[model samples]
Target: MTGTPRPRTVLLTGASGVVGRSILREPTALRLLAATHSAPAPEADGRRIRCDLTADRLGLEKEEYTALAGEVDAVIHSAGLTEWGLPAERYRPINIEGTRRVIEFARHAGATVHFMSTAFVAALAETAPVALSEGNMCRNYISSKWEAERLLRDSGIPHTVFRPTNLVGDSATGWTSKGQIVQLMSDWICRGRAPFLPAHAGIRMDFVPQDLLSKAVLRAIEQDVSEGEFWVTYGAEAMDMDASLRVLAKHAAYLGRDLTIPPVVDPDTLTAEQLAGLRPMVRNYVAVLRDVSEVTRCSGGVLPSSMPELRTRFGVPLVDDATAYLRSLEYASAHLS
Candidate 1:
């Protein structure tokens, strides 16, 4: 990795985010500038800069913006609103417009960008088994990212786009800066709170360990990958619904608790009476789970993957998927709960 010429100083936007923290933890020799909103980042001791994505020049003074532009030749564009279920308008100012600002800054800095996009964008595909409505939980968020990717593509800037599925934890130690949606949803299921698994048939549950994603990005940076699109997902190698439930059962045994694996229910089959029978909160949770399952099922029954490319091109280790997930669950049980 050291033999290749890489960027001297790299600007890391969203330095306080989960992916950003994982990147900070990864071994790297490049000097990194942590561009954050307001929260102090790991690099806050020296290279952290506060910025507003909605503001021009990231809300930095003219001199500071110029100084930053001069210092970096590469950017890890990881910043954006990732929360699901928000209105379309809520995502515009941050995810879409903020990316536009980042593109402007990159243009000024003459820096190549490595963007972090979500695999959930597949949900909006015309080939999806289930059609997604405007009110679908993450439709707007996914669309926003898709638009941002389009912006970078049209800008004629040298950039790489990585569409990662839901991230879990480190492959070895299962460490995460915070619990991601994968962990939270797994917890809810394993704790026997999920009345039934609301998912599409044959849809694989794809969740990649965060560190692998971090390694992929850093290696792409180190190798000076000029232009490419990669899906950092497990695809067919990912666990199926039955396998996922078995992992939960294993996790329960590890915790000295017995768990009943919930029956899988296709949301489309549920009648109004059955839907009304669920408590309001459970109904909402089920709806979210169902929508997420549909999202996972978008590109046919399985999501598209770039795992083989990641390993061959970037030297990412192919750790067992279920093992990584169990380690994550164990870590959350011990540390993050």
Candidate 2:
């Protein structure tokens, strides 16, 4: 009788990132080769490889690169800059060129690739039916991701692109990477410094816990086919602005603080004085909120229908929106301060 077949060895980039670590936590039959740019790599089960995606050959030596290429059956490219305010020039090397290098490496290794991208790649439209499907126009950070996707598609390597929306903390412990824009907003709200927000009732905000996203990624790797685009999101089940604030208010009540819900201001109708009332940091989000509101107004707040089917097929759990928001607030309260 044949012995049990050995588990396929997969190389994972961005092993130090939020989603990367989450993927590392899940038990899987695959042997992981985790790559990191920093000195001290994650203390996990994988064979840690020090490599930079932006560097030539991912900064790996000739022998090391050849050995890795021979061993890896698949590659998951999750490492990249996600900061919003950075210029396109700054993001080009890491998000765009880095992806090109990843595809190149995958081709050499004869391995399939899984690319992590954001749902904002759909971009925001000014008119109705803002359906977030493939091939939408976006700019800045999102544009970098779009360009990377294009490179992957044209690379002639077997690949799947996953577009997840706003990622919250862990579903259970609410642990997450600090310095996200959501953390800033939560901080302002908890401090009672934010008196008003530019939002609309119809605006829908999608959030996926890192745990669920990681699981989905792993499933995609294990059940890999030639190619597909998966939108890892809650779709129409996502919470609206008012509902999200209510959840935050509930968390505030649990903490024994009577928080006043901020009034929503329409971005288009805001007077100069009204804009001046917002905190300097919060003011930057005005345009973002307006764009989202416009998308909601046009699309009736509907995400793609295939999202649910994909989530189910991948065994991703349906996270409770209120719990996810509360856990995020709790983590933000303790750490963001």
Candidate 3:
């Protein structure tokens, strides 16, 4: 880190979620109060406490809540419903109102918030080549995070936003607590399950090692940084479609599985009738992929990024994209299969 991590106590919300779990994996000097959803986290690597983000004082007793506010200097707000393709309303309770609750607590505690937002919000940029469709799977999720960021800003609470793209695994060992989208989709596609890859031409496939984000956040806390928006993504350094597909092919070979790499189909060229003709299951997956393409295209085919800053400032490892992606695929095949 920048210095011997300045000791500071932090209330880490969503301590049981993927991002939260990843954060706990990193070594840090900050004192942590891990707020979880239900059952206690035996391996939270910090003190664990059950919490309800939608409730007043996060469901803690008033006296206890006041005490908690006095105990922490900052909050790492990582908890949220991150699943895509859900109805817009499904996001309101957690992504919106839960954030509202966090804001209330931050205000009371005079604590700075280090909010985990999404890089997909780049789709809302003014230079976007196309509008993000309401039908897009990620639209609702991205919109919810955008609203949450605005809430923090309007609340006048001291905060910093870390907007990360899709996460894969650790940069070195490629270990993830659970399977992520890249692994799931790579497995299916490598097995020749996909009829065609519906992705926008020239769009970079941006996925980051989960640990990079964790390191950045911890460094921010150690340094007592109370403001700034960081995009923890590889912009120009990200792999293009061809390289992504090549990795799939390599993985298939490694597994001794026959692979017929699917043809890349432009999302715009695919007719509705053609999409409708696939089997119900295939159609669903294809539609989601196509919609995700719409998300990338809307962001001018490249999401906003802050990789250089992250590396220079926070010492996030500069693992090459293809190398990390391949390692993640190999790790999945070996363990997660």
Report the Cα RMSD per candidate: 2.5, 3.5, 2.7
* Candidate 2 per-residue C-alpha lDDT over 99-152 given as tens digits, one digit per residue, 9 for 90 to 100: 998988999999999999877665543343544323222347777998999899
Q: Is candidate 1 or 2 superior in lDDT?
A: 1
Q: Write model 1 residue lDDT over 295-329, tens digit each, in one string.
A: 87666768889999999999999899999999999
Q: Residue 35's C-alpha lDDT in candidate 1? A: 84
**Residue 257 error, candidate 3, Å:** 1.4
List the pairs of residues colliding in candidate 1: none
TM-score of 2: 0.88
Model 3 weakest 10-residue run by lDDT: 38-47
C-alpha-based local distance difference test score of model 1: 0.88
TM-score of each: 0.95, 0.88, 0.96
Candidate 1 backbone overlaps, count: 0
What lDDT does candidate 2 reach at residue 43? 40
**Clash count, one per candidate:** 0, 2, 0
